[model samples]
Target: MFIRNESFYSFRRQYPIITILVAIHLILFVWMNFLPFGNYIRALGIGYNLAVANGEYWRLITPIFMHIGAGHVLFNSFSLVIFGPALERMLGKFKFILVYLITGIIANIATFYLGGLAYPPHLGASGAIFGLLGMYVYLVINRKDLIDRMNSQLVMTIIIIGLVMTFVNPNINILAHLFGLIAGAALAPLFLIGAKPYYAEQRVFVDHGEPVFDPNRWQKKRRNNKRLKQAFWIGLGILVLFGLLSRVL
Candidate 1:
């Protein structure tokens, strides 16, 4: 279910919310890394605990789009690309964006309130990405009709791995991850009021004489099983890489 087989243009047309969000992440990453006054931009965007305590309320929201290291931004962006499209399709554009921002904000708020006297400055989309997993978790338990058994297990595994790493890795904002997950699960039912499951329709929806429903979807499903395994390993690899890089960079 997490495999993104669609082309860039096709995926963008199908999932504008995900596209726009990842775009903002990439742009902000560039501005905060390569451009002039990069440190100034980082200072403004990172969720510095002292800044938030002093009533710089925007820091909570800005941190969602800000990142300091290559591993940090790329890890989050890879996750969004893999998982964001499904939720965006399920929730529609407006609701998807709302949930994304709300979860991220909650993550930031937790970081601010619980980081002792001053939490080390932190920024990344990890919280929001976990929020997406939290939503999938809700579906796995309550809305079983939306997700199949394999995908359900996959979601659970990812969450377990993530939560374990959140505790084991001191570099990550643990509160942010935990609170973001809580927020997402708390908000899932309301946002999923009219939600629907995502189907790989982009490739099948042709303009010409070809039929919309491919007669050989079973073959595709078998292929996707292999893809699911590959995606799982790739995801775990990225998370491990990010964790290692976080320690180093």
Candidate 2:
């Protein structure tokens, strides 16, 4: 389910919600890093507890699109790209965006209230990304028919890795990650009522009227992609170990 063999144009056409979200991520990242008022824009968007307490309520919504650094935005955006399409298809565009935004806003609200004076200023799509993860976890638990065995296992593994990283990483908004997960899981039943599992054969658009998959080219790319996926999983496994050891000894 995680593999995206579709062409760039094809993927964009099929998953406009993911496409628009990634585009917003990139655009906002660039805007906050390159333009003259970059710092000003970032300051206005970050989930600063002080600012939120001062009645800057938009901070609740803005931080979902406002990342702190290159790694922050890119990692969250990559996770969204990897995992979002299925839900976008299952929930349809409207519910998908609704879950994302609501869960993110909930996380920011927690950061505002529970955070108080101790919480550092925070910004990133991590909350929303965790929200998506939470939805998948819900599918794995309560809606087995909506997900295959392989994806269910994969979701379990990813959830473990995400939990490890959430605790291990310094400067993380623990409230956002945990609250977002809860909110998504809580909201999943409502939003995923009529959702269906994603399949590779659903739709494959042609690139400018030409087939996107050529036999030989497809084989080569698949082989390379397999290797990359293997390495990625191994790396994540190592992270789980490292995180446990760090906490234990």
Point out where model 2 deviates above 4 Å: 200-249
In model 2, the clashing pairs are: none
lDDT of 2 by residue, 54-172 (tens): 88999999989986566667667778877898999899999999999999999888888888956788888888888998999899999988887766777678778888688876677
Output the lDDT of residue 91, model 1: 87
Query: What C-alpha lDDT, on a 0 to 100 scale, does residue 59 get in candidate 1?
Result: 92
Tens digits of per-residue lDDT for model 1 on 117-158?
Answer: 467888889888888888888899898877888888777887
Per-candidate TM-scores read: 0.93, 0.83
Which stretches in model 1 have alpha-carbon errors above 4 Å? 200-214
lDDT of 1 at 163: 91
